[model samples]
Target chain A: MLENIISELEKQFQLEAVDHNSSDLVFLTIDRDHAVMAIDLLKWKFGYKHFVLLTAVDFLEEGKFQLTYILNNPDTKTDIGVRVRIDREDANMVSAHHLWPTVATYQRELKEMFGIDFPGSPRLNDPFILEGWEGTPPYRRDFDTKAFAASFYHQREGRTTNDPATYMKEKLYPNE
Target chain B: MSKKEFFPMDGDRTKYPEIKSDGTADIDLSSHKYIKLWHGPNHPGITGNMAVELTLCGDEVVEGITHVGYLHRGFEKLMERRKYIQNFPLVCRIAVPEPDYNEYNYATCIENLTGIDVPEKGMWLRTLTLEMARLQGFLMWIGGMAGAIGFGTVGQWANYCRDLVLDRFEELTGGRIYHIYILPGGVRNDIPEGFKDRMEKNLREIEGFMKDIRRAFFDNYVFKKRSVGVGYIDPAWVFDYGIVGPNARAAGFKHDIRKNYPYAKYAELDFEITTAKDSDIYTRAFLRFEELLKDIDLIRQILDKMPEKGDHISKVSNMMNLKIPAGETYVRSECTRGEYGYYLVADGSEYPRRVNVRGPSYTHGVALLEKMLVNVNIADVAQLMVSLHTYPPEIER
Candidate 1:
């Protein structure tokens, strides 16, 4: 069934069906431009109707990231996985909301958290997180976790003391 | 089937858009409609923090609008901020009623991503816990459905039985509601000294309880009257809406994640996937009951075939700091609620780059419920809602 999908999709969209050892899980690769179209075709032609999830992986050294749309078809009892790679410099993809309405909200969520751009999706302007801020997206690999956590959250204000000195003064040498 | 007649819906279908796009309609908070009804942001008949405004035109409902996003704690997006270990506890909050579903899915994702293999004993333990959770979750669903259908006595009996299962869970995991017990490497502990014997006893007790359920609620005249033909869903739309678990099986879809894609020791268990041919509320409710019985049988199989003495958990070399391989994997499990999946994207860092949770309730609540609500009487709205058994927090998460 997946081979049939791969053959028909090659004519309409640029797709690469990668061979992997992950049995029972079919992973298909598509360009960022045709990701949503491929998703629509898979749903319409095949029985892959359920939108499983949308996630993105960051490759800092390679300077690119991969976004995957996992779908499941209960009728066929099969899983159809579609993936697309976007450059870290210009991370954007066509919004999938036109075909799958639920994907629209998920795309907006990805944009807010990962700083990825989905041009056609509405609600991108809505402040979902980090309202009125000026910085890189918190979800990107380049974003420093320690810096973000220390800056935004509560921590010890401006005092420094050595643990050894405190331990000695409080416990062992009481007279000193 | 005439187009002009438009198949008169039980309520004002025109108020909410036939297609749930961004904004063909908004929640109508005001206006004078004879009987104003608030169907729970906290009241009975509604699950979690959601309410439906029902303006009734005498016993018949004139209009209804749903209000949601009240318990949105943002667990999905927050998962991106924490490491894989920390996210285990966080994901449990997505569905408070059935939390092991999230934990097992999360653990499976990390296991897949890191290429770690759980031991045979660990695998059996995980399977037993999962099936036990399914039986407990089904009992809760039956209770909620019985109460919604006005079978108050049945609800009480089911709740009483479910408490026994909860007691077992608490003793097994050390926590009653959210057992943050399942981890990436393996489970938190081995079966206690006498846990297997205790579980077998509980299963026997539950078997007896299931018999009472058959007599009290399943055979009751009102339950059969209100449930059999009401809230009919086409079996063909199962793929379209992406329904899962007993709901999908009830509609004649033979998709069992455990059988089709065996993750844990489910491959070893000998059990049939419970399904129902009728596509109505009663069939849906009965499918869950049948699944409860099947889960009891599966739990027995796990206890019997499990390795006698072995490590229950895999040792974690480092908990706080460890470099994750830069890769992506979507791991799905047959959770009690439905097909719970975790889409984990690692970036060679301690924390995950993107952690999106694909829960069944999200699709079931929004897309599927909108379709099922069509032609259903507003009086049966809560009953249908309870029968569907959606956890809204999982959706908004």
Candidate 2:
């Protein structure tokens, strides 16, 4: 079923079948230009109406973040994972909000977290986190977590707090 | 199939409320007819922090506005800062009422990425815990549903039974509500000595409690009248909205991930997938009734098939020493409400690069609630919320 769907998708979009392991499913990495169109076609032509998830990954070393859309077809019992790689220099893609209305909020969330621009999405301005955030997006791979946390958040001022295991050892057996 | 009949909502039509239209829909702010009522932040019927602004025309709701993110603590962003082991306790707060789901899915995602398989005995134990958690969640659902329809006695009875389940959790994990017991590699510990007998005793007590639940809740005429044709959904909407668990099952869809995906020991366990055909409040409520029985049977199966010799958890090095290879994985599980997915991105580090939770409540709260509230009466607001089982924290996360 996945092969059939991939074959059907390949006719329109520039698609490459990728390797993924979990259960019965096939993943394909597609060009960003055809991401929305391909997904719309799949949802319309095929029975893959369920938008399971929409997530983005930051690959700083590779200079790109991969955005994946996992869709499932309950009628056929087949799943398809389609991904689009957006370069860090121009992290933008046409929003799938038109085809799947549910993707609007998710796209806005991805924009806030990864700093990717979804030009067509209506709710991109809504604040999900970091009220009045300035400078860089907090979810980018290049964003240094320790530095950001130290500069922004309030830190403990006393001796370093120990973990659960260390705290148990220290409090329970003081002499030892 | 014929369309399901729903009770006519009682109320007058009013104007739109205070939500500024962001190019989606225009509101006539000049009109003085509409009254805005906020039902959120802290409310008896609502499970978590959520507010629904209803523009009422007398008793009827004209325009319903959903307000989420009151309890949003940025859990996904926080997951990026903590190590694998350090996140166990934090992720439990993602869904406060059903915290095991976050732990189980997070653990399963990491385990899938690291290629660490749990032992047979551990699998059985995890299944046992999952079923117990499902029962606890179902009882809470029943209580909340009953309370929504003014059946206060049902809430008392179901909550009383739920306390017994929480007692078992407190004995096992030292936490009544948020049991961070289901880790990635395996459970926190083996079932304690004579724990099976104790669990059996609790199940027997719950079994007796089910009788009262049927008598006071299901058998009651008032509840049936309130729930029989209320909050009707087209059965086909289950496929479109991707709803799961009892909600979809009640709508006549058999898309149980446990049966289809066969995670943990669910493949080995023999139990019926609870389903119904009415797609109304009563059928949704009845699905829970069938699920309670199935939960008991699955727990018994776990106790019978649990292996004798196997480690409860694998010995791993410190969190700093553990590193996941650079990859991405999405692991989904059948939670009490619906299908919950955890999409994680690992960059060969102790902390995940990205953790996006596809919580089920987000779908129900935003898309389904907005769609379902188009012509519903104001009185059915709490009932709709209860029947849909929307968790605001899960949505906000």
Candidate 3:
């Protein structure tokens, strides 16, 4: 059933890579430009109407951010994750709020956390969670959370915490 | 499909703001027609924290902007640096009401990525905890929903019922609120002896309270009058707005994750997806009440079918030693509110490359609340938000 749908999509849109995680879940990695167009086809043409989520992962060494859009077809009980890779240097993608109202929220978070801009998205600059955030987007791979917190937030005296695993190794198995 | 069929919202037309060419409410404060009101950030009538910046003309809300971040803790960011095992207890804190779903999804995602199979008995126990989480979550939601409409006694009764379920959790998982029971491979521990009998007794007591809840809360005229036709969700908005669980079900969509996807022994469990066409506050509340009763039946079914003696958890020698292969997968389950998910990415490393929490509240609490608040009475905002069944911690996560 899924083969037929994928074949049909392959005939229309340019297919980059197709990998199956499970029997029902198929991951389709497409070019950045044609990602939303394929999503439009999946939503309007195929039965993949339910927009599950939109998220990005930083592939730091590769200098690219992989954006994944998971959509669900309720009728067939299947999911297709459309992945698109955009350059990290100039991080921006076409906005998808026209497809789903909730996509705007995801885009807003992406802008605030990952520094990924979604052009034409409403309230793209509004902070979703972090208030008055001015530094590098925290979710980016290069952003050091420990360094940021130590410099930004103050700690009281004698309030130092220790990692239990590391503490156990230091106290019990130090000679190893 | 028009909302007016459900309930014709009444308001003074002259006082109402006009819609601009861009489809936004032309809420000019200089005209002195609308006054801005903040709903919360301080106990906004829900357990979690979030405020709706409402532009009101008289009693009707012209527009509402949902302002959040009071509970933001950067959970996703924290998970990136921590090892896989260190995040076991962390995931449960994402959603306060039903943390089991978070644990289950996080565990299952790692298991899927690592190719770990849970024991049969472990699967059954996970299902039990998930259903139990749903049971207690619904109980607490009943309290909040009833309390929203000035039914304070029912709220007390619902919380009491919720406390009984928490007792069962405390015995089984050693935690009432956050049960880090569902691990990557299996559950934390086996069910204690005589747990079935005790749970049965508790179910009976809860069923008795449920009878009172139905009579005192649902059958009450004031609750119906305040909620019957209010907060109507158009069925068309289900897919477009990413609505799920009871909110989508109440709008005549027979889409439940358990029914559709059938994860974690739910395929064997016998239960019907409760739905209503009304899609308003009262219908959603009543539908959830019915589902709470259904959860009791499911718990009994799980208990009846559970094995007497077997491995409740699989062999994972050390949680800290676990690692995932290079891959990405999304795992979701039917949480109390909707489809709660965890999108995991592993780069063949000890620490997770990225773990994004797809909490149900991320959509329902923010975008859905803002969209639904238009033309609603200031008093009905809490009722509508509660009926959508959103959690602020999940939203912030």
Report per-candidate DockQ. Answer: 0.23, 0.33, 0.62
TM-score of chain A of each: 0.80, 0.84, 0.88
How are the candidates ranked when ordered by lDDT, highest leading? 3, 2, 1
Q: What is the C-alpha lDDT profile of model 2 across B1-397, one tens digit per residue? A: 2223445542222333333446333445457555677877577767677877776655656666677767867788788878887888888998877888899899988998898777777778888878888888888888898888788888988898889988988887889999999887789978777878988998898899898889888999987877777777777677456576778888888878888887888988887677888787788888878887788878888888887678988765564556899877778888888798888778888888888888888777776776677556777778888888877878767
Model 2 lDDT vs. the true structure?
Answer: 0.79
Docking class of 3: medium
> How close to the true structure is residue A92 of candidate 2, measured as C-alpha lDDT?
90
TM-score winner, 1 or 3:
3
- The prediction achieving the highest TM-score against the true structure is 3
lDDT of 3 by residue, B175-283 (tens): 9999899987889899999999999999999999999999998999988888988988999999888999899999999989998899999999888888899898988
lDDT of 3 by residue, A28-126 (tens): 888988889989989998889999999999999999999999999999999999999999999999998999989999999899989999999988898
Candidate with more favorable, higher DockQ: 1 or 3: 3
Candidate 3, residue B6: how far the Cα is off, in Å: 5.4
Candidate 2: Cα lDDT at B172: 78
Mind giving the per-residue lDDT tens digits that candidate 2 earns over A47-94? 788888787887788899888998887777667788899899998988
TM-score of each predicted structure versus truth: 0.80, 0.87, 0.95
Q: Output the number of the lDDT-best candidate.
A: 3
Error of 2 at B352 (Å): 1.2
lDDT of 1 by residue, A1-176 (tens): 66666678888886765634265567778987778877887788876777777767767778887788887665666677788889989988888776665665567657866788998686675554345656887667677867877888899679777789787787887787
Q: Report the Cα lDDT for residue B260, model 3.
A: 85
What are the iRMS values of all candidates? 4.1, 2.6, 0.9
